[model samples]
Target: MNRRTFILGGLGTLGVLAGGGVLFTQRPEFGRLPRGERLARLEASPHYVNGKFQNLVPVQVMNDQNGENRFVAMAKFLFGDKSHLSPKQVMLSKKTDLQTLNPAEDVVVWLGHSSFFMQLGGYRILIDPVFSPYASPLFFINKAFPGSNVYTAEEMPKIDVLAISHDHWDHLDYPTIMALKPKVKQIVCPLGVGEYFESWGFAREKLHEEDWETEIKLADDLSVHVLPSQHFSGRFLTPNPTLWCGFAFVTPQRKVYYTGDGGYGEHFKAIGQKFGGFDMMLGENGQYNMAWHAIHMLPEETAQAAEDAGAKQLLPAHGGKFALSRHPWQEPYRELTKASRDKNYKLVTPEIGQLAYIDGQKNEQFGPWWENME
Candidate 1:
């Protein structure tokens, strides 16, 4: 072959090899795979069927005119000239340990984002426990904050229930579940999420899947009622193959609402009517935008959600840990605080690893510690 032709051929071969390497490294199989057929069948079952879209009854939220501008400015400030943003820096106080939690009382400790350690009536329940650093499909691509996870899987107490809101990677970590399986008693999940756990070696009998608006009694005076949420679900390309909803936990002492991951909807009022009133309502207050308003609620909508659920006080979650959207990391809190002040809603902004005790009549404030991080 001529010298020029040989050089061109060699360059082409190198380019092909480079492309192949990139594809192989980024493939989904390198991460967690979808559930198997047995699990898929269960997830696809009609018992967990969600009604038509009309049944959800979506609520309208007023747009923030300057939201986009603020988002761009904050993005530039935090991630200047970078294509991807790094995780925020966080400092954790070791005042209360998750391992030393009392299983007989009503208490909650924030692990990060939507993950929480909740103890009620001698039962320990964990909600959406994401211990991994990143919330992405590829672990190496995204990163979590350094020294953030206060309690590792090994440090968790004997868990009576592991409750999942959906199958999002940020909410469901495969490695964390495998490590926690030995100590977990039973997993209570929305419609299709149990399939993911069962494929990861969790026993079928240990998995309890509940449909929307269904109620199950876990123990004496401790019951879980699945409520409607305006959210979609999927771990793969198939959307809504499973279901997603919030949960209401009722105890003899007090009632608490965990608004899993949802946007604003009228179902909140129905939930309030069905369950009476709650001492505390944990609602989503982060990573929202006008582009996807139907799927995630803005701070104002979160306040409205609290009112609709008949909660005396509100605990804003789904923020303060991971930077999921374009808004400033602290925007959710700022907006929520303002909305609460204007609307006269009682809101609690808890710090990472802080505890909140709920007694029937009195309300208390925990941590605005996230303010220090700003």
Candidate 2:
């Protein structure tokens, strides 16, 4: 089979059947995990309960809260409210070249969706980058909005650290990871997430799979803290076998929080208390639905989460690239802007590929670039 076809079927590590059964084939393309010593370690982890990882707090998936599918409710959430679901024209964005930027300058480039390229303390960091046209098991579904997929891996500089929150296809593209592996020096992710990277030919030594609240010191001035989040993980069928989380990027120069993808929870307030405060928070503000409200937060909740996290500035993420849910493509920015009213935090709304100066996180310099566009 072709590589795409292999990815669709031979989900060796994460491929799940429509039923609850998980497909654990020996197909090398599927990227196996937990072999030999790794399996022994996984069996001993306290978080790995009943053959899968359990969240600190139980989370409801796309199905009904009881784990049963109510077809009427599911159908409405998925298919209803098609109006203004996406823009008619390609979204315009600023052109950015990472190789041309000054390494000493701390800045961040939002490459659509949850993808971010950040330069801090002479280190280049990438988080949850998916530069593909479609985010799906098949070729046709979840096609990204026009023009949002312009930032390719070729445009990226040598990555000092690649941070992955989970292994979902939308956040972890097979082809994109393959393209980026050579340039990436270190990989940071939730525990068990590096198994996929190791299977994909990454050196074991370069992979740093961290548990919640654990810290990885990068340089004399920089460190990363893996923090807890309320989210589930699975590429295909084996649910929660791997962990999902957010992260706190700590440097002598700045403190940044990245909420990779998750619903609103008290953990936001707790994370803030632990970190003291964040200069900026990269928040998930899209791809939400009431049916699966326990996994993704609504726009107002996204605003509140930033406030709860004690972020001085809110960087809207997980939107403007793909319509993973039924909401209008621009709804996230619109609602987040409104919800932020009278709130303490400043909203940082940069277009895709626009630069977010680390120093500017505290300044109200960015405008609503999403306004008056398609």
State which candidate has the highest TM-score.
Answer: 2
Q: For residues 209-322, write the lDDT of model 1, one tens digit per residue.
A: 777878878888878887778877666555565667788888888788999887887788889888887888889988777756777899989988888888877888887667
Per-model C-alpha RMSD: 5.2, 6.5
Per-residue lDDT tens digits of candidate 2, residues 138-229?
A: 66667888888878887789999999998887888878999997899998998888889888889999988877878988778889888887
For model 2, the superposed segments whose C-alpha errors exceed 4 Å read 1-29, 63-83, 361-364
For candidate 1, the per-residue lDDT at 261 reads 84
Off by over 4 Å in 1: 1-88, 92-95, 140-142, 342-345, 360-364
> TM-score per candidate, in order?
0.80, 0.88
Count the clashes in each prediction.
Answer: 0, 2
Best by lDDT: 2
